[model samples]
Target chain A: MQRIQWFKWLSLVLYGIPMLLVLVFPFIVMVSTSFKTLEEVSQIPPTFIPRNPTLENYREVWNIIPLADHFRNSFLLGVGETFLIMVLGVPAAYALARFRFAGRQPYLIFLLVTQMFPAIVVVLGVFRVVVALGLLNNLAVVATTAASFSLAFCIWLLVGYFSAIPPEIEEAAMMDGDSRLGAMIKMTLPLSWPGLVAVGVFAFMDGWNEFLFSLTFISNDEMMPLTVGLFRFISRFQIQWHHLMTGSLLATIVAVALFMTVQDKLTRGMLAISEK
Target chain B: MSVVVCKELVKRFGATVAVDHVNVEIQDGEFMVFVGPSGCGKTTTLRMIGGLETVTSGDIFIDGVRVNNLAPRHRDIAMVFQNYALYPHYKVFDNIAYPLRLRKRPKAEIEERVNTVARMLGVQHLLDRWPRQLSGGERQRVALGRAIVRNPKLYLMDEPLSNLDAKLRVQMRREIIHLQRNLGTTTIYVTHDQVEAMTMGDRIMVMRAGKVQQIGAPEVLYNHPANLFVAQFIGSPAMNAFKGRLETDDGKIVVATEFGRFPVGDPLVARLKPDRSPTLGAREVICGIRPEDITLDDAPVTPASPQAQVDLVEGLGADAYVSLTIGGTTLIARTPADCPPAENQLVTIHLNPNKLHLFDPITEETLLALP
Candidate 1:
């Protein structure tokens, strides 16, 4: 057993070293570049780490871009869109989950069909509609549009979650002095919380990093989310590599934080879905 | 306690009639069980009575009041599902208290009642534990506790013990019967297991093909089944049925089969239709004999006794089931397990004519009753 354990650990280190290097190498290079002066960055051979690291890149990025406002806009839009997706998607998913009315199968098919078409195909029409509605440069409009684009996926994910709960549990509740609606609220919803969290986190990440819809719908700098705002760091005349790298690192950190907050729930949701 | 009456209750799901027109009356505090094979509409009937399913046609009355339009909660009934249906997320205390909470009972009363029932069920120690943390038997008790805490007008149980292991099933069966008796609560239990029906129910309702075949006490149904379905359904190993003909032999009625002619007693003669065909209406009648009623002897005592060849013997400790072939007909005789005759041994088996059941070939109705 001891020999086998040592061999297994040896193989694990051999396999893990390259994977770790590949993932961390880029972030390390970016951080090192962000800390270097323009002269040092332009050197023939790149340095893995700067001789002297400074916080100047972060300060320059914040000063050059409306980083605080952009961060606020991204946070607001992502949270709002994800919340709207859950609010609208859960009920629609539940309706498809429990009831058997006419056109239910077609309705589900229609929702799935929405996911089939890439966003680029409908971007023009959606832009025209947003312009007509006079919501072209509004963050609320951007959030709503992002929600509409992602709601289909959220509903699809939630449908699997809702349907995974045994119908008998609801029936048991109904028999235990509850109406159908009451039974759903009291039994099914509580049991499916993990699935809800999983889908919620997925929608959050999707909206947080979304580039196309935010770009097409919002043109104003104040309403520009982090994805679009990050583009301002690059120009034809000169590219501020340090600020861009710092901003990219910041975005990665934010997304990772959001994911880590709900990581346990995500694992539970996957287990729940697979078990069912 | 309340009397539940279903008058011509019918349920149709799209094109299939899950429950056909069926009528039954369950008296106050009576433990009525609907027992049948799968897809026999027993669970559907129980659901209809509980108002879980909408009635296609017919009225359901509780305490002499029509309740077909009432919701499940308004019907003031509680049900225990086969899978226990204890809320996996809720602690045992909350699960038993859910019904009372829904009814908006006083908090003190809910707590008191929950604790009382928990103690009664011997689950007080498990009150803080979630349902998934409990064993199958403990979960079953919690389910029962949830149903009983409310003191509802009726208790509807749908095969609650069907999920347990064999030994636990038997143990829980006795507990359920004792609980029902002590509480004197009207209950309607549904199960496909006839043993549960025979042991637990005050009256067993045998159903088949979305209809009630027979409704009687266990012993009554066992001895005097209303039809061939009930006879075959109610007994373990089932009643042995063989095709035979009813004939008048010297002013006495006798069942004539391919094997031989056996005299039917005078009590059964009046029930036989004289105008029926040689098959007792069509071409053959069914004769049912319980395994216990047939006896195996080492030698034939009289000329009329039939000689049997023992095919197999199943030693069951207290008794042995001996399969025998008489002429071309095969039958099983429950005999003493000790000193059972060896396989292929020739023996004289006597069929107890008094305990025989005769059914019409065409209608499958009981043509004669045992004395």
Candidate 2:
């Protein structure tokens, strides 16, 4: 028994070390490079940690690139798009989960078909539509389009979540003097909070990092989101390594922070779907 | 309090009929139960009356006023579901106060009613806790409290005690019966367990294949079942049935089954036809006998006795279930627990005439009693 226990511990450490390194190594490299000067970043074996770490690269990136404006734009667009997706997706999901109506199957199939198409294929058409609507330089257009793109996926996630809740709960509410709509609000919606959070976080991440739509729709540098603004650090001939690393690190930090906040909900939603 | 009447109620889902023209009158302050096997439409019928399910075609009357088109809330009925259906996030107090809150009752009145019902159900201590924090029995009491606070015209319970452990189910069953009696609310409960129906209902509606087979007081249904289904369903160790030919010997009728012959007393024998099919349907009848009705004796002192070897003995403390094989047929005899015969022990068994049930093999209809 002791030998087996020793072997189990040895194997756990052996497996865990590489997994930890793989996950943390990239973030460590990015953070270290963010603090290094342009000269230090171009060193012959890339330094694990900066020899003389400084906040100079962060100040340069912030001053040279409108990094603050990009941050604000990204935050606003991501939150707006995620909120819209949830507003439209939650009720649609509850309807699909609870009620049997005409054209329900066809509607679900159409929604699924939207996810099957690659976003690049429709980029030109989407650009044309935005231009025709006179929304080419507007952040609202990018936010709305991104939200529209994520709506189907969010609804799909929420449908599974809503269905996982026992129908008897809603029926019980109905017996307690609630209308069908009231029952959905009182019982079904609250029970599926984890799914809502998971979908919200996913839409937020997608909108935060989306590049093609933001780049095509918005020409004003001030309106550019983080993903598009980050490209300003790179030119055709050379890359500003310090500025690029700082900006990337900041974006990574924001994404990771948002994800960590809702990580429990995401795991729970995924588990609920898999169980069904 | 008001009586509920369902007349010629029919509910069809596509091509299948769930409740086929069921008609029942539930009296005011009476506890009525709809009992049957799964998919027998007992639940469907209850839901129709509760207005949870739309009636395909029927008239449902509460207090002699037709309520076929009324919403469940408008009909003033409260239901307790099989899973308890307590809102997991709500405290027990909030759950019990839900109906009153929906009615926009005064806050103080809601609080008083919620507390009163919670105290009655012995769940007053659980009011501040969420449903997930309570045990199964506690959750059930909160669900009951939620229903009782409404003081609706009628109460509908759909196997509310089914999810509990056996001991808790029995305890809750008694509590529900006592509570309903004290409140004097007309109730319509649905359950697949005949034991619950027999013990708790003032009258049980036994259904099969979307049709009601019998409806009567528990003892009446047990002693005089309307058909083969009721005869088999109501008893604990379900009534044993033997297929046999009915024959007249010396101007007396005898049912000659594979197990042996049993005399059909004069009144019952007259109900059998002499000329019957080779299927043994006319002469062929089913002899229904409860296990308790078969007497096991050491000696065959009577002419109406059949000899058999005991196959198995199940001692249930209060009674012994002895399985015996006679002429290639198995028969269960309920005897005194202390004097149970051993397996393979030879014994003479006699079928009590008064306890025998005769049914037409073809129609599966009870022949002894005419309705």
Highest-TM-score candidate: 1
Model 2 TM-score (B-chain only): 0.94
lDDT tens string, model 1, A33-145?
87876667767787777877788888888887888888888888879888889789988999998888889999989988888888899889988998998888887777787
What CA RMSD would you report for each candidate? 3.1, 4.0
The CA lDDT of each predicted structure is 0.85, 0.87
Give each model a TM-score: 0.92, 0.89
Q: TM-score of the second chain in each model? A: 0.94, 0.94
lDDT over C-alpha atoms for residue A206 of model 1 = 75
Q: How do the residues B1-371 of candidate 1 rate in per-residue lDDT, one tens digit apiece?
A: 99999999999988898888888999999999999999999999998888878899998999999999888878889899998887776789999998888889999999999999999999999999878788999999999999999888999999999889999999999999999999999999999999999999999999898988989899999998888889988877778888987776766667777777777655555555456534343346799889998877887788776788999999989999988898788898888888799999989876677777888767898865434
For residues B263-349, write the lDDT of model 2, one tens digit per residue. 766665554434432224336778899999999888877755678999999999999999989888788889989989888888898
